[model samples]
Target chain A: MKISEIARLVDANIYCKGNEDTDIRCAFACDMMSDVLAYVKNQAILVTGLVNPQVIRTAEMMDIPCVIIVRGKEPTPLMLEIAADRGITVMNTKLRMYSVCGILYNHGLPADEGE
Target chain B: MGALHLEYTVAPDDFSRAGEVSGIVKRTLKDLGFPPAVVRRTAIAMYEAEINMVIHANGGKITADITPEEIMIVFADQGPGIPDIDLAMQEGWSTASEDIRDMGFGAGMGLPNIQKSTDYMDVQTTVGVGTTITIKIFVTQ
Candidate 1:
């Protein structure tokens, strides 16, 4: 699925549009950075409610291309700056994490099965 | 190609600047034409160690020796060292406080994740003194 389509489906406001046309292969939703690092195996879109710089850091480490902040939580300015610097797209939605994940899953975005 | 050595200083509990080193290393690996898998593995392993230094120790020093064959990284910190390596290595045993958990880490998966990401890992520690973790990932051409 293209990143823009996912954003449209979730009604997300993309703060840092890093390759909006890029295709998303899978999605992983979690508030725990460690779980994302331990479980995510491919380049995927990260859906979470966590609003910290570590979220961006974890995505950079895991090569996650996009992060969707759910529950209307806004990312810190530092997080947005880092996301922009890393060329990782950052978005936010008023919907909760579960709803965002469900919407994306319903749109045919698969979950990342860890290796 | 000659080996490239890089060093970074991690500020204690500085959550905002935690992943800078890993980002630089990742960019360097990409510039050097390493495979994506190799670069990601090296980045993830080193990033976890860097976070550990900031969270557990009061920050530390990170050194990376990158060559065409492999990348070796060492994280040395002078904080309260791990008392039990076995217990600390467990997946669900974490000593991080709730504040750390609110930041989306502290799940006790740091060491195990590092182990899984790297080809080799070594831990050296002394309680109340410090800890040093060394990890290496080979670049397959």
Candidate 2:
């Protein structure tokens, strides 16, 4: 799935440009960075409400190209700077975490490496 | 092959700056033309080790040696050491404070996750001395 499609489907506001078309190989929804590290195996989109620099660090390490900040939570400036530097598309949606994940899952995005 | 050595000092308890060194090494791996899968594994392992240094140890120094066959990263910290390596290695066991968890870490998955991402890993510790963790990843993996 393209990153822009996620943004449109979830009613999200993309904070970074030029990465709208980045291919999202999978999706994982969790605020726990450790779980993301332990489970995410490939290019996955991180759906989380946690707004911190470590989130970006996690994505960067995992090579996750997109991060969706849910519950209308926007990322901090430092997070945005890091995401921009790392070429991660940061998107924010007003929908709760569960709804956002359901929408993406319904759209045929695999939740884990097994799929 | 001869390895390229790189070093960075981690400041204790600085959650904000914890993973900077790992990030740099991750980028360096890419610049050196490593495969994405191998690069991501190394970076994630190193990142976890680096964060553990800040949260558990009183911060530490990370030295990485990069070679065509493997990348080795050593994390040495001067803080209260791990009393039980077995427990520390267990999943869902952690001594991190609530503050650390609030920062999105301290899920007790650090060491285990590091082991999963690396081809080789070793841990050495003493009660008062500190802890040292070395993780190696093969390039051909």
User: Evaluated with TM-score, which candidate comes out highest?
Assistant: 1
Which window of ten consecutive residues has the lowest lDDT sum in model 2 chain A? A16-25
Write the residue-wise lDDT of candidate 1 on B1-141 in tens digits.
799999999999788888889889999999899999999889888888888898899999999999899899999999999999999999988999999999888999999989989999999999999999999998873
Name the regions of candidate 2 deviating beyond 4 angstroms: none
Candidate 2 residue pairs that clash: none
True contacts kept of each: 0.89, 0.80
What's candidate 2's DockQ score? 0.84
Candidate 1 stretches greater than 4 Å from native: none
Q: Estimate every model's Cα lDDT from 0 to 1.
A: 0.91, 0.89
Best by lDDT: 1
TM-scores, all models, native as reference: 0.98, 0.96
Q: Report the lDDT tens digits of candidate 2 across residue range B84-132.
A: 9999999999999998899888899999999988899999999999999
